[model samples]
Target: MVRKEKLDSMFNAFSIVSGGNYVYVCDMKQDLSRWSKSAVDYFGLPSEYMENAQSIWNEHLHPTDREYFNESINAIFAGSDNNHTLEYRARRLDGEYVVCVCQGVVIHDDDGKPEYFCGSIKNHDSVNYIDDVTNLRSLYGFLDDLKSAFWKKQELDILMIGVEEFSRTNDIFGYTFGNRALRKLGSLLLSEFRCEGQVYRMDGTKFAVIAQKSSIQRLSEIYADLQETCAKEFYVGSDRLTLSLCAGALHLERFSVSPDTVYSCLRFALHESKGNHHGELFEFQEVVIDESRNSLTRLNEIRNSIVDECVGFELYYQPVVDAKTEEMCGAEALIRWRNNDYGLVPPFLFVPILEQDSLFPELGKWILREAMICGNRIRAKYPNFVMNVNLSYAQLERTDFVDVVLDLLKATHFPAKNLCLELTERCRLLDVKLLQNIFVRLREEGVRIALDDFGTGFSSLGVLRKLPIDCVKIDRDYVLNIQSNKEDRNTVKFISQLAEAFNAELCVEGVETAEMRDMLRKFNVTSFQGFYYSRPVPIEEFCVKYSC
Candidate 1:
């Protein structure tokens, strides 16, 4: 049995962590009650309610829940149960319904009659289950609801929605205003799905909806509504923002799957929908399982190879040239994997998988060491030549990242001024202050920083204004059509102007055709890199051709 002192302490601790949770201590003989401050404020109960707490509970509980609530209490009083736990929807002072979980233990007097009940009531509206920013159910709450649905064998249509370019939004407007946009999105979802489903914040800029058993046509209609709604402009702090979102759906009745499997399938479908349907919804297919299984096996094999360093992993250098002179100015290091089973693995197939692994740090360091050593040799012939190496977000987050780079430069006898680190748009989750400090220290050491995949990501005018970068590598998407597509040409022209304003050099990558290179030069872009010059080749070949 829990003593009164222990119950008091538990109640005190519970009130602090559970948001609007309230503890009630009832004296049956005295017919009196006391409530935690949070509970009184949340429910807006008058002082008179303390005198008749039992009546107030019945009055506030929904009519459908009152019978169950009374039965549970009666069962405990009658000695059929030691305690009672109730989960039901109750009416709040605002005439809104709130799901609540309440558990109570009855204490008996010496005569065996119930003397008091100790209970804690948690309103689901509290932040314990809802996201503070979105006001939707959080991941924890989503899991709980999913479990309950599984137990009840209820059919649910699940959708996973992801905000495209959300990271760019945060980078440009700052996270404070980013949260406001998320809140607005949450409000929009709640209003639309109030009678259809429950919206949950699955992760940063990702949301999930669990809808009641509905027809496939209805689901499609809902998806279309969401897509159209999100396409409109968002008003945030004097700035109007346009956003895009993609969604993936899983029909629960079609298969028997665990909660984890549901999450995986939805995520995979979501990824496939990207650039496939232009933010439209994609349904999970049977092939997803086979693909996921094969992918995991391949990922495991590659992870082991990276860790053991037994697989043939090598770096190839592609030359970056001056547009006007057609002279090589620098080289970007690219990785290749020669596996006995897979033969040759292209980066598009393996790099994304590896970068998601924690062990990528080891691979990244290996690349850095090997690239710098090779670059040092190349520099012997051309002292002004620079080598650019891509840095993953994982590598940059390491506390020892800056130190490792500095040490590599010292060990390779490579000039820091000639070794550039390229950060890509794939780095979405970043600590801005931490990255800025790291960049500041690196710049002090004479190391150059470059932003790769420039026009493709959320690289806004604001991010360029704040980030301490030395170069911008325009993504191939923009450069490929710069000569033929007027929009592409205009985007490149604007980016070139921004680079000039920042005093940063612009290197237009994927410059395959003479027309593309010539068009970029018109915008005053001098540095170019792509197949037009040479595909990535072995160090020996690079040394023989460029004599470096």
Candidate 2:
């Protein structure tokens, strides 16, 4: 009776500690030593189950996991390790499989012979499962591991491709169709290559694949096949639609020295492919090294210039001449960088980089104030002269841009009519109401706004009709070949007529020769700017060259 009472207490204690009170003991020779009452209950076995314990356990294990489990157990018996832990799917009594984590430690007798092994199993269905981010099984976990271990490699090759202009599809069709199309693409990739490679849904409209030591021939074949597969039309909810993908391939081993280096190389390749008129695949080349290094160096310098004030920026002016008067009317303000080491980096090379960095908002404010002061000095000498300053898309998006202009105008006391704010067609593509309010306020204050690079982007017509623009400057590409190409002449004529319809003045840039000027004159383009008049000159030289 006392022994029975002690056994009850032990069972209750075990239940409280393990929450299951199930235990199984087996020898290294695959013989069962003991099984607790809770073990029989857990496996749903009869009291006579001890006789066939090995077979019962083996039969319950998932076929896919059985071989690995046996190998791990055998290794532990061979004294490979003292403790073993594994996760596998085990068949429950009801015939459904449950994921379980099992851990065991070996015990030895006084004679140094293996006595028995004890282990407990825990339900891992809730704990070990990974959250799904894509349809591909185990993809997120794989990516997490890769991101953690990727730093060990000096280089990596990455391929990123996705449907072009997916946003338009989402807008035209419903988002449900767009999501179905994306899922179909994901499933296709998973079924094709998940066993041999890793895939990631980088973001909306983008997918990436990573390959380690993939040979050039193999990579080419893979890319060609993917391109062909992605090109095929997909049926989403009975509508058949085809989409083209732009692919960028970067070979990390060749260019990457650090973790960030790989990302940079891949991004540069992606940028090149996107900028191509055709959706072509671009491969990493050595030239990208120099280009990337230059970009990084310039970005760092610009960032430093913003904070330190030790480095300063220079302003160059190019004269704008009146067609009929053949005299200087105004000059456009151009920004140049004069690094102590690099010495005079052109605006073309650095301006776009600055825009991408969104440094233009601060840089734009500085340029405005400086240009106002400079224009005030020029106006003191020549009252009717004007100064045009170019503004970037980022600067236009600022709610405070109008206030900044007003503050500068008040501080400098320059005539508002003589200050021209130049904006590209791209700027007008932003929020319409914000642009309208800003332009209306500026125009009401007597400040003139010109649409620079007039024929470049898609929104030119909308810009002229909507924004309160005072002038339209035709881009140089349309003006350069006007004398030799009929197509260019026709384009110039169309733009000039549009300017007339809008009642805005026209400025034709890039007039290098007399023939170009004559051709422009035929279109009634009055204001001209380019090397034909004078190359952009330093402030001192410009003052001497155009001072009246």
Give the TM-scores of the predictions, in the order they appear.
0.52, 0.58
**What tens-digit string does per-residue lDDT give for candidate 2 at 1-548?**
54334434543444466656355556554454345675566556665225446556777888967876777777767777677766666777777776666777777767876655666677644432232435543333334334423424434556766577787777888787778777777776666555435666754576667766564355556766766766675666677777777767765443223223334445445555766535567775543325345454454565568555425687888989998786888889998878766678777765654563445678888888878788777777778888999988678877788998898899888779999998865464467777789889999999999889888863469768988988899889997777678999888888889989989999988888888887788886869999988999887888887663
Model 1 per-residue lDDT tens digits across residues 108-150: 8899887776678877765467788887888878876775576
lDDT of each: 0.77, 0.69
Listing every candidate in turn, what is its Cα RMSD in Å to the true structure after a full C-alpha superposition?
13.6, 15.2
Clashes, model 2: 0
The Cα error of candidate 1 at residue 384, in Å, is: 1.3
State the local distance difference test value for candidate 1.
0.77
- 10 residues in a row with least lDDT, candidate 2: 254-263
Which residue pairs show collisions in model 2?
none
How close to the true structure is residue 127 of candidate 2, measured as C-alpha lDDT? 39
